[model samples]
Target: MLGSISLDKTTRRVSLRAKALMIFSILLAPGCLGSDEEIDVFYGEDIVPPRATPDFVLFDQNGDPVAFNDYLGDVVVVAFLFTRCPDVCPQVSANMAWIGNELGDNLGTEVHLLSITVDPWYDNSSVMQNYAYDRGLEWPHLSSDLETMEPIWRSFDVGLETYANDTDGDGTVDGFDLCPDTPEGEQTDADGCGVETQQSEGDVQTMHHPLYYIDHTTGTIIVDRAGNQRVYWGDFVWNADMVLDDIMALVEESA
Candidate 1:
């Protein structure tokens, strides 16, 4: 776990406990003598000397152009996911939804949430729309062609790759395969496993479907009202309450 800290754009930082104590005594406590401003500390990895988030205009689930700059005055939470992802993507989405619900009336006003696809080749505007609707997520799920999304992905430090892996020599790529372990040189079904693997007997069924699996960084970034990336919480280590605290802290900051 990365230690938290209180940081500002000039790379000035202080220990979390020290800053917490200071804030409590000077900013929160009654009759304390100090400036009216409050210092914020985060529970996630802080971006020291924070930098501006790359701005882009992408189509949302509704096929309407959405610009990142338009959300400058709001704290933004950006999540990277793909519609076809079988595991981590959905978990990340659920985490984001939890944060969204906790935001309450502040959502879409003081805080903006966005989910951008890592597999834009497959997750077009319609696919993004369907995914969002099916999952009951009201936030914008953005998608565009690979050419347009690559630079944005790079700017956000999103590590991404697509693979056509067939671990058991099956004709079908692992992405679309329901069964993963097919025998060598055996014909497979649409699900990528032979009858021997699927049924109780040794028989080879012939069918193939080509697909690619996308592996990407499953993390969410919190951008401050200044449009700078401030905190990052990886999907595997997310704590909903801590994430919410980080966001609200930024929302409390003066513009």
Candidate 2:
């Protein structure tokens, strides 16, 4: 059900290796290639030859076990985010909410959404519930212990790492340092020690820093009805209308 690209002068193979090159081309010229007729190309990075998405079981905000395979029949938008992410994560979630509003009743029917946490250590069930509730996003925000979650992160190609680097010589790592450029050797509060769990405060800046950040891939992946990854939209460059078109195309294809 993935959309096709119309290229008047370009020839490219459809594979993961080719995806990078296509992304470059997409950035330069986003739509059709022909001069006379405009053809529809995916606004998001297209996975030419779609790859099967890995399946996993993770805990939702309710601490309920949800398996990826269980949602195979629906077109799922899988977004990787952390509640502690300063900016990008909330933007992606808001975009998802817009898409949900556009979907109307179809939000939970033919199409579905998932928000998986990159920082599972601090994004536990209660924290995730608060995140969803505060944002009015009624989708699964999932997490698990590192042992159970690391494999899932790898499967999804999430580039994840945690480190303690205090650039200002503060006792806290940069990830947890609210005042990253604090004057060197100046005594500060325990802000760098990390929070037990971060809640969704209105201001991203006011949120407590984690002991260390779970820096990982940032984006949403569209999975087709058969559990294959079809397209990817970077968190920062989401086009809600185009994303909806892709979802409807997949849903209509199944119909």
Per-model C-alpha RMSD: 8.7, 10.2
**TM-score of each model, in listed order:** 0.76, 0.73
| Candidate 2 residue-wise lDDT, 133-172, digit = tens | 9999889999999898888777666788887677767566
Q: List ranges where model 2 is wrong by over 4 Å.
A: 1-41, 169-172, 175-208
Computed on alpha carbons, the lDDT of every model, listed in order, comes to 0.78, 0.74
- Which residue pairs come into collision in candidate 1? none
Candidate with the greatest lDDT versus the true structure? 1
Candidate 1 off by > 4 Å: 1-40, 167-169, 174-181, 184-191, 199-210
Q: What's the lDDT for residue 47 in model 1?
A: 70
Q: Whole-model lDDT for model 2 versus the true structure? A: 0.74
